[model samples]
Target: MTAVFDTFYADDTLVDHLTKSIQYSIQSGGKRIRPLFLLETLQAFGIPISEAHFKVAAAVELIHTSSLIHDDLPAMDNDDFRRGQLTNHKVYGEAQAILAGDALLLDPYLLLSSADLNASVIVALVAELAYASGSHGMVAGQVLDMDGEQHTLTVDQLKKIHALKTGRMLTFPFVAAGIIAEQDDEIVALLRQLGEAVGQAFQIRDDILDVTATFEEIGKTPGKDVVADKSTYVKLLGLDGAKQALTEYLDIASQMLTEIEHKTQLQGEPILKQIERLRID
Candidate 1:
């Protein structure tokens, strides 16, 4: 789980300030979930991870973390703590945080393009990653999330927001793994299901936390969702019902992985293993 991020982070005279800011922001040590998913997904397909895996992992994490930086700005989610430290906008000023986020988004492909992977593979992965992290996925999800808070939403409406904000990024590794491993679509689909369920459950946990956790324990201001009066699972179905939904979908996701264990033995990955292990028990 300890991956070095040095190579993907570098010095550029032109973007010096932004680079420093982004690097500082990344150095704060976030969960590294997306990159872990990408790495583990590749490993799940029997790819022996090496320096290249670390490189790709860093690139993915940088993209994800950069999004968080922009996401927490005054115009966005607007809070203080991120990755358990001062958020980029709070520490670097809003403008620098913006440029840092832009740099982080573009720099990953630049790094990936320069990597030792097959040219076409790198290009396609870069393009797909950009699309998923950009307008078609995470960015779109954020816009919808903002809009979601502005009004009440039905279950379908909330699900759409989760599919983008939480699910797409989670599903990303499944597709990226297939691309890198040359896997069949069927396996990729199963993995996507697992990823989405993991994300949905994770989002539900977040909602539960919003109601239950404190500003100190959770490392950020608590009850922002309550403040927003946003229609969360808690607001929609009640807390017990929300937890049950998380459990039910997570169980369904666990069942999906049974089709793959005979091959990949992917049960070693923490997130995947945790879900599957829970289901089996």
Candidate 2:
């Protein structure tokens, strides 16, 4: 993926300069966690990816990337760095960055709905993605985070902040996968819980990284949360207490996955592995 991205970015020999500029920043490093979570959730449900799932999964990744691009902008987070490199706006110029981010945001739906997935599944996924990426989901969370600056919030309030900002979008893939796989209601519910827990753990880990991680390790500006003065579990609770909370969430998430009984296949699912790792710290 990284190599393809690099080559894709370097394809300036044929494309227009503006396109090249946007592609350069848009094709930067990312963990691809959203697709991975969706894939694992589908696997846990004993479903194989059809051609349609792949398209939708790719859409999931595109949306996640789009959010990161906007999040790194000077106006949004005033961030100079992202994915361990200069932000899109830093290298591409503000105008090109805006276009690139907008292109990514708008492009994925065409990609997802373009293929052979059932109309119902596509519609549901689109609605889920829209909510997650829009005012109710990731964008909502960002607004809360921005509003939270310089203000102390209760732990519940902080969770609410991240649940909308970070958790909902992260959880979207799981819900989307459940819909794609046509899982039972109980199983879908389990995936939802697992995803929320995963999002919370991921955010807490990010909070830890902000304080304990180096700028090089994170590839983006560290300690921005501190500068922003956004409330975090690490702020309300000590590092050790935050770690404890992560463990509890991970355990809760793992137990929720037991709904698909005798489904021994889920034992090695990557999402489950992620939950165990989250428990580690």
| lDDT of candidate 1 at residue 170, scale 0 to 100 | 70
lDDT of 1 by residue, 200-242 (tens): 7767777877888777667777788888778899899998888
- In the order shown, the candidates' Cα RMSDs to the true structure are 2.7, 3.1
User: What lDDT score belongs to each candidate, Candidate 1 first?
Assistant: 0.74, 0.75
What is the per-residue lDDT of model 2 for residues 45-164, given as tens digits with 9 covering 90 to 100?
Answer: 678766667667777676677777788877878898887788878887887777777877776787776758789888888998898888888888888888888899899998988788
By lDDT, the best candidate is: 2
Clashing pairs in 1: none
